[model samples]
Target: MTDTVLASWRDGTAKTAILDFVTRATRQGPDFVPAGDRIATFDNDGTLWVEQPLPPQFDFVFRHWAEEVKADPSLAGRQPYKALIEKDPSFLHGVATQDPQVIESLLKAFARSWAGSTPAEFDAQVREWLATVKQPKLGVLYQDLVYQPMLELFDLLKANGFRVFVCSGGGRDFMRVFAEETWGINKENIIGSAAEYTYTDGGMVRGEQLLGTLDLGPGKPEHIFARTGRLPVFAGGNADVDIEMLSAARFALLINHDDAEREFAYTAAAEASLAKAGELGWTVVSMKDDWSTLYRNREQ
Candidate 1:
C-alpha cells in the first residue's frame, strides 16, 4: 500500500508505467500473468551499466589482445587485432554503437581471444578483468557502474513474481560471472552470444569459432527463444540491438541515455530503436527525467 516499489524512479510516465504493469500483473488482477510466464528480459552494457566509449567486455578483449600483440606482432594485422592495435576512440565508439564493420571485427576479436579456455578458466579471466579495469570517465570499477534505477526495477519485478533474465549482446559466460554478484540474478537466467565448445579429450573446451547467432539486433530474439523457450513478456534495453527483443515483449521499456551531465548521452546509436518504441507504444524512460541518480554508488 506504499508508493515505494520503484522509489529510485521519479514520479513520471516511466515510473507510472512500471507501477501499472506490476499491479495489473498481480495474481488478483484480470490481466495477471501466470508465475511461469512472468518473464522479464534485460540487456546489459548500455542498459545496465556504462557502455559509452565501448562495452566493458570489449575493453577486456582489447587488453588481452594488446598483450597478445605484444607477444606476437603477427596477430596485429588481423581484422579484429587491427582495431585493437589502432585503439581508435572513433572505432571503439562505432563498435559500441552500430557500425556493422566495426561490430563484426570486435565480435571476431572477442571470439578469437576467448577460445580454447574451459568455462571455469573463462570465468576466472573475466573476474580478473573486473578486478583490474575501471571505466574511463566514471573512473569506477565496471561492476560499480550499474544503473541504480534499473537495479530497483529488477527488485520490483522479482517481488512481483517476474522471472528476470539478463539477455545481453555481451558474452554469456562473461555476464554469468557478475550477473549473480552484480545484478542479483541467477547465472542460469543469463543468455548471450556464445563461443562454440566441444567435448574433446575429457571436458567441454571452448573453441575459436563463434557459434550460434551474434545475439545483437535480430539475433536477440533468436537467442532468447532458443534459451528460454518463450517470448519475453517484459523486456528492457538501451540500443537498437535490443529492438527485436523489446518488440517481442508485451511491455517494453527503453532506456534513453539523455542525461548528459549525470551520465553520458547519445541517441544516434538507438535512433531506430527509439522510433520502434514510439510505433509500438513502449515506455521510453528518459535517463535525465526518470532517474534521480546516475549509478548505484551515487544517489540523488
Candidate 2:
C-alpha cells in the first residue's frame, strides 16, 4: 500500500510531509487520538480541488438564479440577488459585513430554487456539470483540474487512521456530491456552508432558513467547533479564509500555489495568509517548490 501510494507522489514535499505527519500522528498509538478522535479536516475548493475559474457551488447557485430570473423577470431587479445574477463579485466580497436579513434573503432564494431536489438528483446535476463545464482559461473539465498532491495527501491521512472531513465554505450538499463521486468520502463527514431544510408531509422542502453560518474566514473555525465538537489534530487549506481553522489544529498545512508552469502561480493571497499562519506556527507547503506533481492530469 505504501508503494502504491508513493507511486502517486512522484517525489514531492507534499507527499513527504503528509506521510511523515500521518506516521507521527498515528505512531502516538491509539491512546492519543483513540478510535473516535482520529479526525482530520480539509478545506474543499482550493484545498482539495481546483477553485480557479469559480467555486462549483457558486456556479450552481448562479446558474439556478439565472434560470429563476429568466422565468420571473422581476427578480432581475432585486438588490443582492440581482447583483449576484449580474456577476457582481462585490456583492459577496465583504459578505461578513452585510445585514443578516440580506444574507438570509439571498440564502432562502437559493434554497427555494434548489430545494425539493433529492440528494441523488443534486449529485447527478453536479456530475453532469463537471463532465461538461470547462474552465475559462484551462479549457479542461473542472473535475479534471483537482490537485493531485492534495488527493494523495487525503488518501495517505485516511490510510493512517484519520477520518477525513471537508470543512469548506462550499455548500455541504454540493461537497457531498463531489466527494462521493470523486474521492469516495462519506457524506456524513462533510461540513460546509448550509441552509435550512425540512422534510414534511408533502416532501423535502428547502427554505431560506439559515442553518448556522457561512463557513469561511473566521467562520471556518466556528463550523469546525460546531460540527466536530473537538479540534482537529491535522488540517489543510490554501487561503487566508482558512487561517482561523488551520490555526485551531495541532498540525496545519497551507497548500501554497506558486508554480505557474505546472499549475497556477498566484501566491499573494496565500503568502499573506502564510505570514499570519507563520506567526501562529503553521506549516506552509509551497506547490511550486514542494510538490513535483501539482495536478492529477499530466497532459493538460
Quantify how close model 2 is to the true structure by its C-alpha RMSD in Å. Answer: 3.5
Ten-residue region with minimum lDDT total, candidate 1: 98-107
Model 2 Cα shift for residue 34 (angstroms): 3.3
lDDT of 1 by residue, 1-300 (tens): 366777778899989888888888885767888888899999998899988777888888878888998999998898677865787677767877856566666766677777787888888988998998888987778888899889999999998899999987778888998888789999899998778899988999988877776878888888888887888999999888898899999899999999888778888779999999888899999999988776887644
Clashes of each: 0, 1
For model 1, the superposed segments whose C-alpha errors exceed 4 Å read: 87-90, 98-101, 200-202
Worst 10 residues of 2 by lDDT: 94-103
Q: After the best TM-score superposition of candidate 2, give how far the Cα of residue 146 lies from its true spot, in angstroms.
A: 1.4
The deviation in Å at residue 155 for candidate 1 is 0.8
Candidate 2 residue pairs that clash: 108-208
Predicted candidate 2 versus true structure: per-residue lDDT over 1-300, tens digit per residue = 457774545565555766666666666665355646777888987787666555656666677677777888998898556787676765564332222344455555666666666555766877787777677677777777777767777777777788888898767877777777676688888888776777877666556555787777777778877877877888988887787888888788887767677656665446667787678766777766666565676553
Top of the candidates by TM-score: 1
